[model samples]
Target: MLGRRATILSFDLDYPALYYPADSGSLAGQRRFVRATRVRLFALFAAALGGAWSWRAGSFDLFGLLGFVAFAIALGAATYLQATDPARSWYEARTASESIKTLTWRYIVGGDPFPLSLPETAAEKLLRARLAAVIDPDKLPAPSPSAPTKQITDRMRSVRASSFEDRRAAYRDGRIEDQRGWYARKAVANERLKQTFTWVAIALELAGFVGAAFKAFGQVDVDLLGVFSAAAAGLAAWTQARSYADNQRAYSRNAYELGLIADELDGVSKADWPRFVDEAENAISTEHTQWRAAKGLGAPRQRNAASAPES
Candidate 1:
């Protein structure tokens, strides 16, 4: 009973508790850092050119010295940003969180070790070992302990603890339908964002080109060229950092795969529940592991979270 309850809590709260924050944090950190760095690079480039232009035009003065100082400062800031890399920390946590989520789903649905034929204590030991394989020894950024009320606890009792029909319905509703809906929405949203960013980047680049042409013909001040160039460069940086096109593709692919799995799940039999859930969990794990790999989240502690169980 206790082991089952633990599995219940892990699925209901623990996985989410880690995944949500880490996912959001990673995106925000990387986006912000990229944007700032781009702006800094633009400023440094603009100042250097402006300084040279001023010197050659005999408008010399303190401008050249100031530009050099600004360039040095930007270089130092970039170094600091590279050294800190807040995005790396978030990526690491995200990897860990997703790995944990896969394990949680497998446990909740009685995917393997928690099969109907297994003893409760042995099932518990297997789950512990599997979890140990992925979770870091240090508890840093671990999911906060749950504080579920009796009402919540009873409602979230393990699917394994439920009636056969209830278990089937839980799988269909929670794993299949909910996942399909979520991923489908994400795919659409990501595609939309990708289009928007691509257009914005193109528009910004065109504006810069127009500004440069105007400067070349002496219709606009040379200074205006720098401003437009900086804007375009920064926008390009944002576009690259967001990687909207790649995200749209990934989300779309995952949604399609999950949709297929959801369709297959409708015909699963009670006698084949173990294999059905195992395959379902495997599908989920495969997509997420690919996601981590694409992001270069680094070699994970458990090596692709070893989506395949070890014992």
Candidate 2:
């Protein structure tokens, strides 16, 4: 086995209990962070350009047309990255969960041969030696085994079955986490969207003011254009405020899910740990119920919310 003594990474004693591995997981996190930053920069650029054009055009009607285009492009980028990088997300999630699993497993199954937790310093040399004695380098558990023989067949089958269950649970958690992150990102975009709308509203209101002044001075046609411009300013302001409220509600729901996941991770040693697997299954069912409720809610108010743009 090609191996070196593993160094202990820093630990977060917070509720979530994040554990950093001094291995490949750390590098993967840095890489993901860099990629997300780049994508956000691109979205910001598109939003800025769209905002500027809508302001210059002096028509509230045009705002919707341009904003949708920008939103589509940014959303497309996010969707593509997520679809292509599912495993990366899985690894990231597993990184945290795996650390907890190792610690909790040791706590559950006593007389642990391997190190229960990574040792931090030379002073922990005794712990290092203890861990090394039981560290089985040649038999790392994975989703599947490469070679199947009679000797390893039963163990491999057990691993495969456990892997499937783990994957299913992990996927459920990932879906909720992704929803949380997406709602957060959407809130950020909504802030920018509101700002864009505010600027346009201000510009339109100013143009309307100018038009009224010009009409007083007998300059140009100030009929429907002037009236609609004033209305647009008020309408934009109302929509921004309403959307902000909706966004807050959406974020609250997502935050709840995130907290649930973090709690589940931290309490791996709870007497009711395996019950979490059952809870996860129930949670999936609960989500389906919530979706149906939302659909029912929309069915009645669809036309009303559509007209008001408050949905």
Candidate 3:
């Protein structure tokens, strides 16, 4: 219900949905959903191919028939279980503001306001400024003024309640922009995945060709359709893998920012601050490396100051 309320109020520019502990708490639910989806898709694809093979061969193999039946059964059962579960329905009843709960936790865990090394996008900065303005300075529970944590928590809760999605639209846009930066910066990982999968797809295609050649030479019976099916599946998997890499990079960048925030909130001793500063420098240096990589290819024209932080 709280999450639902948040979702409704999220439209207002004053409040952005806070992060919820969805990663650790509700991750199992998400994983189950993903697993079921993958299984259903794989089964459907395989069954369709089997059906076509049955027509072409003018016969059906018992194993292939059972595979198709089993897949259908699993898909039906998973869908029924998800749809009929009362708990699932109840969970869905909550408002989208639930994310605010998660974001609050990040603050409590000492996440930085935002990492300085990776400056927030212009849109992000604007969204943050807007949210900061709506927050009444007097309403803020003083962190060091002997006020209870619950007091501050409740005020944040109130803000969440009043927020509309419009207030958060720009923040979401900032997140999307940050995602693009991370993807572009992490192109090496993307390239590696591409190269790896390209080789795998090439290997599968070559093997399929070899099987076709063997059939032509009468070495053994072969279904050219099956050969094509395997090769196509390989190529499709390669494409999906590249997409996964992009998602991974986004997650990595978000995690890094959150960790930096946490470090600042924790208020490390002066002696330890140097090490933290060094880490920040390394991250900034890597960004420079990424920029240099793009120099020959019409590199970005950054508006920020070019001066590097004093080490």
Candidate 4:
């Protein structure tokens, strides 16, 4: 059992069929949202620059025309965003993908609500129901034509059928350790991004202040105060949309909690493993819960932890 790999197939047409498409949709939607936001902000800056140029050059026909064009572009971008609602797609797809992933982990690792003691048929049925519950039919993407159709892959069964020690090892290494490391890395990345954007916004604001002071004192001919202020406002909007600081805090806290949970794995006995796994899963779920809350997603579906059955 130790010689066999415990990894789940990414191309398996079961839960992954649902998972992959939702994940892709979420990424695509996120990219779209970011691109639209950037375009709008850039247009706004361009409009401000054109206005400043028009004022300095005393040519309303040229620079004023450019400002009007830029304003039109910004309006178009805003209309596109409002019509498509990419942010909503990003959030909904992400929510579906995460919910499916958590259910898959629980099913594979013989975690609560899908314990080893349950008959295979019953467990499979429960898993299917849970998967169906998390996703809306309208949002469910079509499965790839070439993908395999097995929900419970041979590898998942192999891991499930392994000795208690092997299963414990597999779950610890594959799930807990992987998640802890991922959260730790994300925490650092988000913190760095937050700091970078924060500094950029501050720098823009400072430049805007200096430009305004210069204009007031007649030290500079060009009116760049509006340009700098518009740019600063754009940066502030992007930073707020990203929520980098909130993510950094949540990821750091989750990583620390997972570390504490990992330490307790070795002490868990066969009979206690189910409950322990549930606890660890709940710890992971907490981060997702916090994420949903931050996104203004009211609440996720309620799933009570099943009592651990005798091993």
Q: Highest TM-score, which number?
A: 4
Better of 3 and 4 by lDDT: 4
Ranking by TM-score: 4, 1, 3, 2
RMSD of each: 6.1, 17.3, 15.2, 4.9
Q: Give candidate 4 misplaced runs (Cα > 4 Å).
A: 1-15, 55-60, 301-311
- Which residue runs of candidate 1 sit more than 4 Å off their true CA positions? 1-77, 137-139, 142-157, 303-311
Alpha-carbon TM-score of each model against the true structure = 0.73, 0.34, 0.38, 0.88
By lDDT, is 1 or 4 better?
4
Worst 10 residues of 4 by lDDT: 1-10
> Which has the higher lDDT value, candidate number 1 or candidate number 2?
1
Q: What is the lDDT of candidate 1?
A: 0.61
lDDT of 3: 0.41
1-311 per-residue lDDT for model 4 (tens digits): 11122243222223434566677777888999999998998998888888887443454557778789999999999999999888878888888888877777787778887788988878877776676667765654455676445656666677677788878877778778888988999999999999999898889888988998998999987787888988888888888888899999999999999999899888998888878888888899898888888888867753342323323
lDDT of 2 by residue, 1-311 (tens): 01222222221111111222222343554455446445544554455444434343565646445656756776765676566563344333333333333332222222132122322232133322322332233222221233221211232223223443453334334433544565577667766766776777677677667767877788754343435453564455445424554555555565576567656654454244444443443443343334334423211111112121111
- Tell me the spans in candidate 3 whose CA falls farther than 4 Å from its real position: 1-21, 24-26, 41-60, 70-196, 224-231, 234-242, 248-311
Our tally of clashes for model 3 stands at 34
Residue 174 lDDT (model 3): 28
Candidate 1 local lDDT, 1-311, one digit each (tens): 11122223123433423344444555566665776576566667656554544443356456666677767767775776788675565566566656656655666566664676676556655655565566553432333355221211233335567777777676677666666676778888878888886788678677778878888898865555566566666666656766777767777777788888777876777778788787777776665666667778645667323343334
lDDT of 4: 0.78
